[model samples]
Target: MIRAYHQPSAVEEALALVARGAVPVAGATGLYTGRSRREAELVDLTGLGLDTIGIHDDRIEIGATVSLQQLAMASSLPGMEGARLRRCCRHVASRPLRNMITAAGNVAHSVYWADLPVALLALDASLEVRRVGASPALVPIADATHGGKHAWDGGLITRIVVPRRAGTLSFGYERFTRTATDYSLSTACVTLRVDGSSARDVRFVVGAVSARPTRLVPVEAALEGSALSDDAISRALAALDRELPIAPNYRAPAEYRRELTQVLARRALETARTWAARENP
Candidate 1:
């Protein structure tokens, strides 16, 4: 038996309600784990006025309740480095599921294969978090969503803000999956910003290969100011060996995942470079 479901239109009211032990549920799609016996207050965030998808200066502010569908529809959001993330969100589960899956909901769950958080980290995004009787503050994407390193206590993710990419940018996503809708065995998000013939900025992120998203910083550092070469890509891929250690899982063996991560990361980077060349030319 579920208790009362409160719908507050403002953040203060919502915080007050949540401080009283209400479980904030933006979308309940991922929380059906046969635990109905342990029912608690489900605070529906649908009416919290947190469903905006618009560009706020150089950053794109995505309200916590913004659905995956809305994300897909607004693929051209300012500062959205790559549409590959939106593409991943669009095919997540099914139409019905995407209709209910919220960006904040998915991130809060911190599922292994959730793609948005990984992509957001690559874009250098920040999350606006608010808690009961505390001042709202922005936390870097890396620190804010670090798996098991830190936890958000009594804090609600209000919005996600991503820095706008300058110059020509390209993005690609690689997911190892049995089908389009299934959770990824491993996924890669790659983005490249170009200035003339040189790579201005490069980002590579792999998901499901570790407990949290691993940003290939060594690879990014190595590729900056270099042309998109097969050798450069190989070096970037090699950097993964030291960055991530995949654990054996039901979906794939540790070795298999490690190799797939390298392959996918390379392919994603190549694809991004190709698109960047075309866009900048």
Candidate 2:
């Protein structure tokens, strides 16, 4: 159980508490969801003023305390980034839960089965964190989640930053579950830039079945410079099944997840195509 709760008034104070074994909490969604078993002191992060969302140098900087409901507001998102964020945030959960979950917390906790991290991963997002007794550094979303090379390691994630594309960019995100509000059994996201009819800079991320979101590199490489056609999409699906290895669980068999991955991948590609057409046409 949490023995004490401390709401530090400054960012440095929070970092100090984190270095001393106190758990820093912005949203505490995962903390209270039985995911965090061991607890020390709860360092409340709300008082540190890490709740602003702003655009600087075409980068969207979201405070660690920004809630899902706040991000779900489409009007607040400036461009394609806003549209993509709203698209994913709307499916997060009911109103009350969205209000309680923080965007940075969503990425920081690295819940493999969650949506926000998967979406952000596909968007090529990064986090700004302050480590104990160290200068703040920006870590890629991939590394921060899933214990990648640059792990969070008890650091306080202060903000989430993603680039704003200056040109036409197509992207899509989709998740599969037993129900609309249920945690996804698997999730996929796609982002690509189009050069005429050819797909370029393709990023395909699959999540929820593993400890971290993964890039479908083989599939992405297959579609990288090719025209997105029915045959190509089918080939990409084949490559996904052939190249992406999945582990089975009681809730979802490996075969089932493999097939579901294809379905979600196709849907995301279709969504990307649709948006690309709209932006390019």
Candidate 3:
């Protein structure tokens, strides 16, 4: 199908075009692989200068068009924050695809196999979205993904904001795949701070096995006030059966995915615990 393509240099112009039914695209990677073949007008968003990454005392701001590869190689990010982002981004597709995949596009597409959202969920990230006639809103990752496409119906995500925690934090991420570039079968990400000998501010997230990345509140609760001992980790793993939701996939059976998720989650937690102990000692 043939159609008009427009590259707007201003956010207002892009928003106006989107309001008029044009589909906005940064990398356009999802559009190529997307199932829908309907003819459509395309609005290019890369011209709007949404490609910079800024580090601030309170938060890190990533523009919508920032590539995963750019994030993986960013030198401004420090400590555990840099480590977590690099680890997750490096696991994303191959190098070439990572260069063409934008963070906003990845989150807005909201595919089950997406890895960035799982790490974002664990990091308590938020999105800044803009619409034609309304003030820009900062939406939490959890709420932004809660209603799927409906939450982003009329707005374009302009940037992502990750708040910096005050104290020392440890992070762990794990994913399982059939090949180096294959879509993930299951993924787990955890971030926690150790206070004395107990865990605090624990955020445990699991992805790919469900329709959307989900925070394991029950499992987080199990670890929140307890030492990350073997017994406590076992109890958290037991909570997975009740909290983790499985979606059917042709790549793997449901039972196999469930067990894989449990194992990956346990490993990620252990990794975080190890880091916490080393850093807190």
TM-score of each: 0.91, 0.93, 0.96
Better of 1 and 3 by lDDT: 3
Top-scoring candidate (lDDT):
3
In candidate 3 the C-alpha lDDT for residue 265 amounts to 90
- TM-score, candidate number 3: 0.96
Model 1 agreement with the true structure over 89-111: per-residue lDDT tens digits: 77677778888999888777776
Clashing pairs in 2: none
lDDT of each: 0.77, 0.81, 0.87
Q: How many residue pairs clash in each candidate?
A: 0, 0, 0
Positional deviation of residue 181's Cα in model 3 after best superposition, in angstroms: 0.3
Alpha-carbon RMSD, each predicted model: 2.2, 1.9, 1.4
Candidate 2's C-alpha runs over 4 A off are 32-36, 145-150
- Between candidates 1 and 2, which one is better according to lDDT? 2
Worst 10 residues of 3 by lDDT: 32-41
How big is the RMSD of model 1? 2.2
